[model samples]
Target: MRILYFAWLRERIGISSEEVETAAPTPAALVEELRAREPRYAAAFADTKAVRVAVDQEMRGWDADLAGAREVAFFPPMTGG
Candidate 1:
């Protein structure tokens, strides 16, 4: 799957996006796998509440299924002035 990071998430992870190969069933599971990869990934996903997810461009929760998903993006919650 193609994983993308936005806003500060990209900065924190030190990359905008990357293709990941995993057997994770849910977005949360994917996060766990990423967090276990290195310190940067761990730090980037330290707070689940502060982050939002999109699977194939549709907003979804951490428990959202990743079956056949081609893209998954992680970003901070949006704010409007």
Candidate 2:
């Protein structure tokens, strides 16, 4: 799977994107796997509530399945003034 990070997520992880191999069934599971990879990933995914996810470029909840997803993006929720 191709994982993309944005804004502070990218800054924290120290990369814009990465390819991962996993058997995770859901987005939250995938996050747990990534977080186990290193401290940087752990920091980036520290607070699930503060993060938003997109699977295959479409917004989804943490419980959303990642089956057949080619891209998964993590970013902070947008704020409007």
Best-fitting candidate, scored by TM-score: 1
* Candidate 2 displacement at residue 69 in angstroms: 0.7
Off by over 4 Å in 2: none
Best by lDDT: 1
Q: How do the residues 1-81 of candidate 2 rate in per-residue lDDT, one tens digit apiece?
A: 999999999999999998989899999999999999999999999998999999998999999988889999999999989
Model 1: how far is 39 from its true place, Å?
A: 0.1
The C-alpha lDDT values of all candidates are: 0.97, 0.94
TM-score of each: 0.98, 0.96
Candidate 1 shows a clash count of 0
Stretches of candidate 1 exceeding 4 Å from the true structure: none
The sequence of per-residue lDDT tens digits that candidate 1 reaches over residues 35-55 is: 999999999999989999999
Alpha-carbon deviation at 28 in model 2, angstroms: 0.2
